[model samples]
Target: MRFGVAFLGAAMMAGSGIAHAALPAGFTVTIEDAGVKSASGAYFGGDINNYGVETFDSLSTGVHSTYASTFGGSPISGTYSNLNVHKADQYGGAGGNNNYAVAGISQTGSYAIDFTTENGESLTYFGYWLSALDPGNVLEFYKKDGSGGFNLLGTFNPTDVIAKVGNNASGTNPYYGNPDGTFVGQNKDEPYAFVNFFNETTGFDRIVFKQTVASAGYESDNHTVGWWKSQGGNEVPGVPEPATWAMLIAGFGMIGGAMRSRKRISVSLA
Candidate 1:
């Protein structure tokens, strides 16, 4: 059930223009940019052994330097310098109901979530809806070493994923006209995406979301985590359906044709 190169190759060939950071062998990443929170929930929350999503609805509005909660069956604690909870309508393309989202304010803005379980179980899957991506935003993953220290696994950002998945930040993006339509036509330049990280060989227990630049803010909602498992007791990662693959292939075909035509014109002009 580990989706390795064969699945990735099909996704690429089908034109599902998603890109990912270089991960350890047997790790993979998937991204969804065109849909709303429910879509991402279904994608990541289904057909798993355990799954949960943190919508930030119950938290009081304001800054939270330290927060603790349980997601799925995993106990999680978060520490941040300036994590602010704001009404979802305040930000364009922010996921969740009309509730709230956690934001890392500009300048020294960052948050870290540590999964603490006495059993020392690792999580093989993670996901979040990242809204209004800026160049300064970064997402880092870490694994706990046996000695209470954390080993950095990988670092990623929205721009890198968007470069592979094509920008869908326009008004046509479904999230722009979400329920209540409060965020319509706002923050059109910044893309919002649901990013999925999966590891088949080794799992991680720590994740960090930060904004490196002083000018930008990191806003996101619907933090999700899960352990991949099928009803048959086999480990299986969530993958795109056949219809999704067909759609991606058609989209990629068009893009490829356009690029080829542009290349021909450039050669002729040269």
Candidate 2:
């Protein structure tokens, strides 16, 4: 995939001192007992036990998305290329709600969430739920490379992203067997499996989710509305951390002391 070399260089120069380590290869998927929750504005760092992990449920407005990217206080902001949102109903006699979750566009193409307005933050890890109603549906993740473009991170199976819904009893709709992994409820869980990458501290300003159409006319509805956690960048650190600031101040103090000592010695020697 292509990268934004110039932008990355500038970013590192500007904030490497405060930057965290790169996210490692592969991501983690946790099954939460609570149902998918929606969050807005800046993402607050979650509980300490989760190590600052914060989960957000992203839902589409059921309308065409544009550059502005706001669904009335939803944490989602991105463009939908030539597609509209779809809600679940009995499509082709399937009674499951997978076909009607947020971001459930069937056309299978690339969709993005823009966080550039939030000062272009970074994230170490990110995962979202996808509903591949049919077997052939596929999804992929990408992050901005910084040059106004995208870089592919990983490809996901609809099977891999199915939500674990026992935590929410209302979602109990029986689902067919998935070749990937079995779900807790016979009913399909709004898939929340996350693909972990080795880079643990690399913050991503934007996330791109792409869908692959199963067949010529048949489309798998995409659902990003379930809970998914991120490692960092819920709130962009516009300034250095306290420790970094302390180090800077101490460095300046040492430099001043050394200059003073050198001047005194020269005077004495003279």
Candidate 3:
């Protein structure tokens, strides 16, 4: 084969392998501020194939939405049904109806959540969550290492968000705090909360969100986990799902069969 054709084939093969997913390493998960009616349209994780976000509005009020989606309603393929969706927002109101965010629960105190991808994913550093209250409430992040040890990434009081982030309210960088916080702002008071963090360099299988210890459960608005995606200029390519592998194999097989049949016809003509 000519060098040009060989190079084109290799490029084409590489293009076929690109898939939808966050990069496992050196990826940044950014969480922006949310309010009753947030005008700012943004995402914490990577781009979605549908709906852009995995909002559990399909769930009931004050109930955990059990699904294998990243956040919205997209389904995770195959037996890799580890991605679960949980939402605590009970004040369910449509966008611009009552100026309410599909998320943002009035539940008081603290709430927690834990997620573990099948093979475990490499994370940049840590993650953050949103809530309705902040004063006296706390949110903590932890990652389970390969040795089966749970390491505390960091503890954040929404009240301290403004002080820490100061002005960075909406950047890809981890420290770009949430200024539109509805929870206890840096442990300040109600209607003023923000539980967000940033990356450092760590590989964690499981991520745990420990709500600030209190009498009641806190309203968990969101959890931001930043992973890089190959389609989005990922440093490393992602592995294809089982179904994708089958399709690729079938496509190549058909091409091979067609080529062999064409050669047979050519010999008969000659």
Error (Å) of candidate 3 at residue 141 is 1.6
For residues 1-270, write the lDDT of model 2, one tens digit per residue. Answer: 111333222322333232122222554433222222122112223422211222211334233334343333334334433333343432211133432222223333445554432323444433333222322234444567768787666544332323222121233323222212222232232222222222344444455443332221112332222122443212211334444533322221121111110010010100
Alpha-carbon lDDT of model 1: 0.52
Model 2 lowest lDDT segment of ten: 261-270
Decide which is better by lDDT, 1 or 2: 1
Q: Which lDDT value does model 2 have at 222?
A: 26
C-alpha TM-scores of all predictions = 0.65, 0.42, 0.41
Candidate 1 clashes between residue pairs 3 or more apart in a chain or in different chains? 14-249
Q: Candidate 2 at 175: error in angstroms? A: 7.1
Q: Write the per-residue lDDT of candidate 3 for residues 7-36, one digit (tens) a residue.
A: 323432343332222233333323333433
For model 1, how does the per-residue alpha-carbon lDDT over 115-160 read when each residue is reduced to its tens digit? 7554568877777776655444677788889998988877765434
Preferred candidate (lDDT higher): 1 or 3 = 1
